[model samples]
Target: MAMTLSTPPVPADWTRHTPFSDPGRHAELLEDVAPSPEAIGPVVRNLLAHYRAEGVNMPVSSRDDINLRWVEEMLSVDQERHPGRSLQDPRATEARLQGCCRDHTLLSVSILRGQGIPARSRVGFADYFVPGWHSDHVVAELHDGERWRRFDPEVAPESGLLPDPWDLEVGPGAPFTTAAEAYRALRAGELDAASYGVAPDHELSGDAFVLTEVFWELAHRYGDELLLWDGWGAIPAPEEEMSEDLLALLDEVAEQLIAADAGDKDAEQALHALYVRDDRLHPGERVLRFSPLGDGPVAVDLRRGEDAVTRPGIP
Candidate 1:
């Protein structure tokens, strides 16, 4: 499952951003931290200390969106020192000091790229956390010219929620999963998409939960991290809305994803091309806002390629 296969050279593009992972946007925040390219491990550790998950003691008003840049969220430990920063600016993330899983992963990916290491954040299920359910999560994947390594900078031993323990150099699962894996398993009826969630009572997970994340991860693999509020083509569309064409497309993506993980560069490129070709996944952009738990509707910006444009959280 957690086999370490040798890797080929990642295309240079992975070393930079695809709109979402842009580090240059917040150069000052990442300046001296991981100044050198080889300091990836230290960068991961630094972030783990800097962030606390959204639900843990953090107010709901402060923690909803996953689209934030690293600068503001990372530096919140001392905002008084760094005043007058925009919430969207990456520089402010450092001052804000906390975020959800994607935030941590993005910060790591952004910092790693700043150091010139080919890295990207991946979305999928993390099995090591909750038993029986594969909680939707994200982690950073870095290719150091020789092999691709996965790191989870979010949950550390002190996080208290990590009972199974996480291997920063390897990520979760005996064989960690991506959107493709979840798609194949769902299609095969091996696993229920609704079964995957942060917790059983959480409203975010539903019948189409896994499918939605599949498209999100697909978008990320293709160089963009379709925001948490983003909708991808017909992915989270209603059951009646899922066309035969989309199902066929999912099959193709699943196949390529398997090959991509197996060291097939061609397959990897095809996946990115397919994503770009379907511009449906790259809908313009959604400028939304985040609200806390008790602060009314929270105005959740849920886009399922569907009409309902609100969510309680990342579903």
Candidate 2:
């Protein structure tokens, strides 16, 4: 008989989290998150048709020209959607026409990377014409002839100034203190995945500090599901159990990191505090209120609670 949910076997390779380590195996596993390019052909065609109809010339010579033309030709100035509402897939680029600003830009990065172009993912807050409230953003950068040129997969003409990675201001403070500080800043709402020019594409855990790179891969697959957790294992869950398997998976990751001495002393200490001890973990039956912002992404503010620890103070 076919395997059913009642007798579900834990997947074999949650332990391995590498990017396309085995292209064949990865392709098989990613069937759920990424669509095949062939299936997306129609979408790409439509995007290209739209651009052509508008008389916007798409260029593909040097990376810079290609990036510039992509920005200028593909995207419109009408800002209707927030960045987070739209869904993304690795294979969306396979569509002949490309997608809206974000879709096309992500595809552009994938295509350039496929062609062996040296590229890097950028993520952080975006402040274009909009102001004050920071929005999460992602993009790609390529080394054109002499210098590196920034590219946005989301914009048509691809015109926007990406602040220096260290220069980004999330809310009250500079979100990241170091290059890898993004891992922490994300939870505090100080830094966003897009600010790094790469979509985070996953929710993550605090214990993830140990196998940082590996965690990034896993989180990417389930961008919205992973939570910022401290410990691992099938312990008594503080919140409604989303998936016991996921909890167990995190436990396994924590064990691996602790064994490997993955993160810094603070991270190690935090992990221990969260799992081995229960005091650091939030107690059950406490309501944490977040104020719904009328304008930007939901700004979180602590209304009142005895269990509330540190309010994610957004300055």
Candidate 2 lDDT by residue in tens digits, 1-315:
111112111121212211211122122222222222222232233333222222244323211211112222222211111121212322222222322233343334333333334333344334452343333344344444333345443433223343443123332344222222343345346643442421233232222322232232222221111112212222233233435554445545444333323324454344433433342222222222211111222223222234232211101
| Most accurate candidate by TM-score | 1
Q: TM-scores across all candidates?
A: 0.71, 0.28
lDDT at residue 215 of model 1 (Cα atoms): 69
Q: What TM-score number comes out for model 1?
A: 0.71
Stretches of model 1 off by over 4 angstroms after superposition: 1-12, 35-56, 59-98, 158-175, 237-241, 285-315
- Best lDDT among the predictions, by candidate number: 1
How far residue 109's Cα lies from its native spot in candidate 1, in Å, is 0.4
Number of clashes found in candidate 2:
35
Tens digit of per-residue lDDT, candidate 1, span 134-223 = 777887777756666676666565656544233343322453478777777788888776668656777667556776666667666655
Looking at candidate 2, the ten consecutive residues that score lowest on lDDT are 1-10
RMSD of 2: 17.3
